[model samples]
Target: MGNRLSKIYTRTGDDGTTGLGDGSRVGKDSARVSAYGTVDEANSCIGLVLASELPDDVRALLVAVQHQLFDLGGELCIPGHAAIFEADIERLEAQLDAFNEPLPPLKDFILPGGGEAAARCHIARTVVRRAERETVNLARHDAVRPEAVRYLNRLSDLLFVLARVLARASGHGEVLWNHERRKA
Candidate 1:
């Protein structure tokens, strides 16, 4: 862990190939790269959400999530590696339960829009779902921990709950979708 990234541009990937943590090189467009890139996108989306003013506890949880996402990315970079652990998934599940406990039962579909931070969280949730899908696809061809996919699935749930929490915290109630009502 001593300056593993001393140089940002290694030029090694200039030829459309990138190095893995296992010292192997693969095409930049490989499934592994795609999976990791999606995870990275989810991470960045969380960062954008974090940029908004949030409660201290929520901020702390999101910060931890960012680190876990990095671990998930590392696991993707090195195929067959289990960088993301069960504890990470458990943490998300705990947060999900905590955040969703107070919300009224969802009897109807909810729109993704809410407060700015909540909207961003929903966007991140969609990215997490995409990442999970890519990870599952990559697993079809290579050895991937089932936990990684499980973690992403749970994370997307957590993000949804967090978005709802944020909207409530910001005094913006959930945007319930009126399925039967036509837009004027």
Candidate 2:
């Protein structure tokens, strides 16, 4: 990792191909690249959520998640690299439970809107789901750690809970879906 990114533009991807962490080149549209690229997109979405006002604990959790996502991206970039582990998934589950414990039980479906920050968290949650799908697709073609997939699965759940927490923290509360609302 020494001086690897000293120069920003390498002009090497002009051919629609990119290099992996193992010095191997593949098409930019390849499954592996798409998988890791989606993970990066999810990370950026989380960063957007972080840019707004948030609870202290939520802020810390998201910051750590950003780093974990970087590791997940690395795991996808390197064919045999093992960045995600069992403990990481366990941590996410524990955090999810802690944040969700005080929340009221959901009897009605909830919409994405809760407030600006909460809405953004919902968007991040969707992107993480997409990343999980992409990673699962990549697994169909190559070796992928089960923990990686499990991590993404658990992360999306954590984000969903966090969105609810943020909504409450911002005093917007949950926006329940109105199934009986008249539609034009």
Candidate 3:
């Protein structure tokens, strides 16, 4: 880490290409970059939710998730390098089960609002979905591991459930979709 960032502006990417962990440069719009970039965006959204009120266990889980996302991004940074472990995906699944156990079963689709924290969670959920799509696209064109895509898929589902949890914490329940209401 001694020489990690001696200079903030390298000026090397003046041509719009960035170096990968493997020391090879590619276009900033490359699939690999897009995959990890969206993951970073989702991570930021999750950070916003973390700044709001959340249960202790939920907070801890999101913190762990942030680390896992970093690992995932790192994996995408280097070709043929793997940073995500099977245990990471398994842990996400376990947390999903624990968080969803108490929520009432959904009978219809729902909107994505219920106060600030819950709304932030909903935003995070959409970003996670976009990250998943980007990862899947990267996998289709690159030699990426299947588990990376799997992790993003599971994370999206977890975010959805966590949004519901946040709504409950705010005593708003879920704002279920009202199809029978007046047309917009």
Return the TM-score for each candidate structure.
0.94, 0.97, 0.96
Residues 60-160, candidate 2, lDDT per residue (tens digit)?
Answer: 99999999999999999999999999999999999999999999999999999899999999999999999999999999999999999999999999999
User: Candidate 3's C-alpha lDDT?
Assistant: 0.91
Model 2 segments more than 4 A misplaced: none
- Top candidate on TM-score is 2
Worst 10 residues of 1 by lDDT: 79-88
Residue by residue across 1-184, what tens digits does model 3's lDDT show? 4798778999999999999989999999999999999999999999999999999988999988998898889899899989887888898899999899988898999799987889999999999899989988998998889889889989989999999999889988788899988976
RMSD of each: 1.5, 1.3, 1.4
Q: What is the alpha-carbon lDDT for the whole of candidate 2?
A: 0.96
Candidate 3: residue 150 lDDT (0-100): 88
Q: Could you tell which candidate, 2 or 3, scores higher by lDDT?
A: 2
Q: Number of clashes in every candidate structure?
A: 0, 0, 0
